[model samples]
Target: MIVLDYPYVSKFLVESVRDLGLPVLDTPQVRELAGGVPLDYIDEIEFSARLALGGKVYTNSENGLEHVLRCRCNEDLARQVDICKDKALFRETVANLHPDYRFLRVSHAGLSGLDLSDFPVPFVIKPARGFFSLGVHVVNDLADWPATLEAIETERAALNAEYPEAVVSGAEFILEQVIDGEEYAIDVYYDAEGNPVITNILHHHFLSAADVSDRLYYTSARIIETWLLPFTEYVRDVGRECGFNNFVTHIEVRVTPEGDILPIEANPLRFAGWCVADITNLAWDFNPYECYFKELRPDWDAILEANKGQAVVMVIGDLPPGTDRESIGSIDYQGFQSMFSNTLELRKIDYKAYPVFAFAFARMDEPELARLKLALAEDFCRFVKMK
Candidate 1:
């Protein structure tokens, strides 16, 4: 029996699991159309108790849900997840394994008394336990430190106001030396036997040279053709060093101009956020959800053969501050369609605040991609309003 939880069990995942001839016990919030044993009447504790009796429990839920699962179900899984969520802990773990890895931890009280003179310029600052890029800031020099702190303070206030229980609330922050280069994220699952299998690698495109906001991500067959071997080997080494086994992780890394790779962080018990991993279906004709539960490795040779040179970019729409879902009157679908003729999917997220999420996918070249990205941003501003 397979146990699934809230915010993680999607229709696609449920249907895919059923297609594999497996039985599932899903949380109440999941749509009934997915055809699972519904457990909506019971609370998370009861749900967890029921899940513990099952053979394999599957969840993509982060933060609170994850903590509950760790406490009620699996201790090892919890430890691994905790290690990943705490940037300082993650850095220590990696540094212990690899001498070159390093990061600094700052307490909440220390933020006011931080001495920036000793540290190098151009460092990255983020909450020790954070999500959705909340409280993330880049400090280019001592002069920028104050602004960065102010931004973080504002972000923390907004986040705490909106999500009082978020991990970012009242959490210490960590600072790491910024590694300049291209960034990439790879999703992996280590099976029951502790063998790691990589499912997908996405190339992250930022909004600008100075801005670190992830505006777009593209997956292509070229990742496998170029970086599969070395990247996978590196992940395996990290896993071995960290004693991670029977886990699912999303790992981010920076690749220097000379081709040196440095890990940013590891997020455990999930592939990517907001169903981004589903892009594999279009790129590889494979279902990662099924692969994880069934412990199956993708047919890389066939997938690579069929998708050579083909790419799918997922353009994320993060609107500027003060923009809310109600602010947007309606999406001009026709105008949007005309702007990006190659668009495969487009939808605006129903959310409360700034960084309102929307996304579109397309297969196009560099110039077209840039144009489509700009057009999407503009269309969002044009169609949405301050209500």
Candidate 2:
């Protein structure tokens, strides 16, 4: 039996598990299916009890529910997850592992009364535990500090207003040195024996001159062809240092022009947001959810050998400032696809607030594909208008 919980109990994931002919229960539906379950609200204690009923539990979401199971099943993994969620802990843990492991100097700050006089120029300000790039800003210099705080505060306020239950009240913000390099996300899952398996490596394309808002990401079979050896070793080292095993890890890394790789952060148990891991099925003919639950260790050498010459890209539909879901009508899919001849999938996201996100998958080669990604990010608004 497999128990699914909130944020992870998506139709895509549930159906995928059912396809395996396994008995899966979504936490929320437990009472509906079993009338006497006595689960009034779905929470860590309730979900933890369900997990004790005998089979494996799985969740892609980082919410407390996942951590509850981890705490019960694997204390070390739970620690790793907690550390990853807190950026400061993650930085300190990794940096203490090796002398070469470098992280930018970071200090906690509040929305009001933040001082930047002694801080380095061009630093980054973000919540210690942040998601979807909310409350993230680049402080160019002392002059940009005020605007940066205002932007973060405004975004945080709007988010809290819309989702009061998920408020970030009294959340600690961290200011850190910004790395200069191209960003990339490496998705991997480690087996029970702690061996790392690389699922897919995505090149994160962001708006130039702006440090936030990843506009698009491109993943290709060639990623394994190019960085399989070194990247895997790097991840394995990080995993060992972080003391994580039998877990899903999404590592955000920065690659410099001189070929140095520095980790930005590690997100556990969840691949890219919004079921983006499903894109791997189109790119590699494998299901990530199945791989994790079934403890399948991929034969990367063989998988890469077979799936050469394949590529997939995901474009994010970021809502412009001052725009909400009600204001934006719909995406011009026809016009959008016309720009990329190899478009595989395109869809507009229905979001409640600003910074709305959607994804477009495509098959194309790099260098050329890089240009198309930029064009899509720049011209995304052209395809969306007021309702």
Candidate 3:
């Protein structure tokens, strides 16, 4: 069963839900999006009963996490959600996996009075239940605290109103040492037996140390062959830690200079948000939703053979903060599309309700790595004519 909610849904997902005839939890948002699409829609009562009876579940966005919590009758599943939702709690559950990594949690109201004399410089501070890069900041110097604090508060005010607290909590925050490495995102699910099957692995690309934006992520065949087993094993360990089964997660981690895998966080019950999971189709010719719902696992050996020498990228054209959403404007989507030679898909989002303008998926070769760097550095506001 799937429970989808605001702020965004994708055509790919709606079609997949239709094709598979999966039972969708009936809600105005899902009805608004999936109505007349021939989906199997079920009411809350039936949905909750099915979930309690051990039905496998998936949600398109964390915004739907509220539904899961309310309908949750399984204490173990609820515990898993808590461990994944609360970053401080997550750090505790997995402490045995990395005992030296330190993290501290403080209430939102307590951040200002908190003394950081004992904490290390260059640490990351973010909402304990953050999603996307909202409210996430890297503090490099003591002088930057006031400005960073101001930014966090501004973000907190918006988040507390804009999303469900279960999705992005504004009350509590986590401060942890930065894990320096090339970051990677993995989309994997554990079967009924708790064995993990990876669907996709993406490299999170950034322009510099202070960059926390999710502007660019790309995947290739070589990455799958190299990191698949190690990441799968790591996720298996995490499942054991949480007693996870019949679960799906999109996990982020850093591969340190010394080749250590340090976890960043995990977004449970979904693949990448906002249909970034669809990039799996653009990259490997299979839908992640189809894989999870149908319990189908990719034959990695055969997949890597056909997917070599290609890079499929998920490029987010995020509108900068402070852009007036109601202002009259026109976007030069064509100008952005012209940057890629082989565009796989271009999804224009409702930036009026959400912060992103578009999600562009493209296929590139090794020589075009510089082009991705250009995308990473883009503000994308230049393409917008605000009145």
Candidate 4:
């Protein structure tokens, strides 16, 4: 059963749900979001029965998580969700796996008075329960502390107002050591038999060390070839440790230069937060949702061969800081697409309601690494107009 909840839902997911004939958990959001589109919807009672029978579930957004959690009849399912959602609990749950990793959870109020002299420096700090990198900041030095705290303080109240405490909160934050390595995001699920099956993996490309924005992520034959088994096995162990199965998860990790894989954070029951999971379909000709529903493992040998030396990139057209959304007249999507070597798909977003101009998918050859770099450095403001 699928739960369609707030923030955003992609057109591809809606079409996938209909084609697969999966039952959606009926709610007002279904009527509002799907409108007259045909769908199979199961109510709370029916959903509960499916859980009792070990039916697998998926959600398009974390905002819908509360509904799924509230109606689930299994205690283990709820525990899995809680452990994945709360960063503090997630760290503790996997503490033994990396006993030397440093992390501390502090309330929002305590941040101002906390002493940082003995605390870990060059760490990433963000809301304990965060989404979309709202309060995330990387401290490169002790001198950046006051500015970081001030930024969080200035943005804290708005964070609470903009989202449900369930989806995102400003009550507490987690400080942890920064793992230095190329980062990747995985869209994987534990099958009914409790084995992890990975569908797609994206290499999250950043402009610099201090960059935390979801600006650029790309998947290629090379990315899958490099990290597939290592990530699958790592996540499988984490799932086994947490007693998880019959679910979908989007995980991020940083691999050290020594070839060490450090678990960053896992988002349970969803993929890549919005419908960015559709990049799996765009890149590899398979829907991530379909993999979870049908319990199918992708034939990577064939897929990588077909996509050898090719890269499909997901770019988030993030709005520049302090841009007045109220004065935004339009986004020049055409001008934006011109930056890439070969454009695959471009999705224009409703900036008044959300934080981005668009989500784009592009295909590039190895020689186009320079093209990806150009796109990354492209001033999004050049493509946006003010009223």
lDDT of 2 by residue, 1-387 (tens): 444433323345556755765454445544443334322244555545554553344444545334444437545655766777777677877775445543343433444565556666777767776666766787786877667666765666555553232222226666667778978898888776678887778888776767487667778777768777778988888888788776777899887788877788887666775567767776777887787768775677787777677667877666666665676667676776676768777654555543554566777755577568557556457767678
lDDT of each: 0.69, 0.65, 0.86, 0.86
Measured on C-alpha atoms, candidate 1 has an lDDT of: 0.69
Clashing pairs in 4: none
Question: In candidate 3, residue 292 scores what lDDT?
Answer: 91
Clashing pairs in 3: none
lDDT of 4 at 96: 83
Looking at model 1, the pairs that clash are none
Clashing pairs in 2: 317-358
Candidate 3 local lDDT, residue 59? 89
RMSD of 1: 3.4
Worst 10 residues of 1 by lDDT: 33-42
Kindly list the per-residue Cα lDDT of model 1 for residues 48-151, writing each as its tens digit: 66555533444454543443444447666667777887878888887855576446899877997888777777888888877667677888778887787777
**What does the lDDT come to for candidate 3?**
0.86
**Candidate 4 local Cα displacement, residue 218, angstroms:** 0.6
Backbone clash tally for model 4?
0
Cα deviation of 67, candidate 3, in Å: 0.7
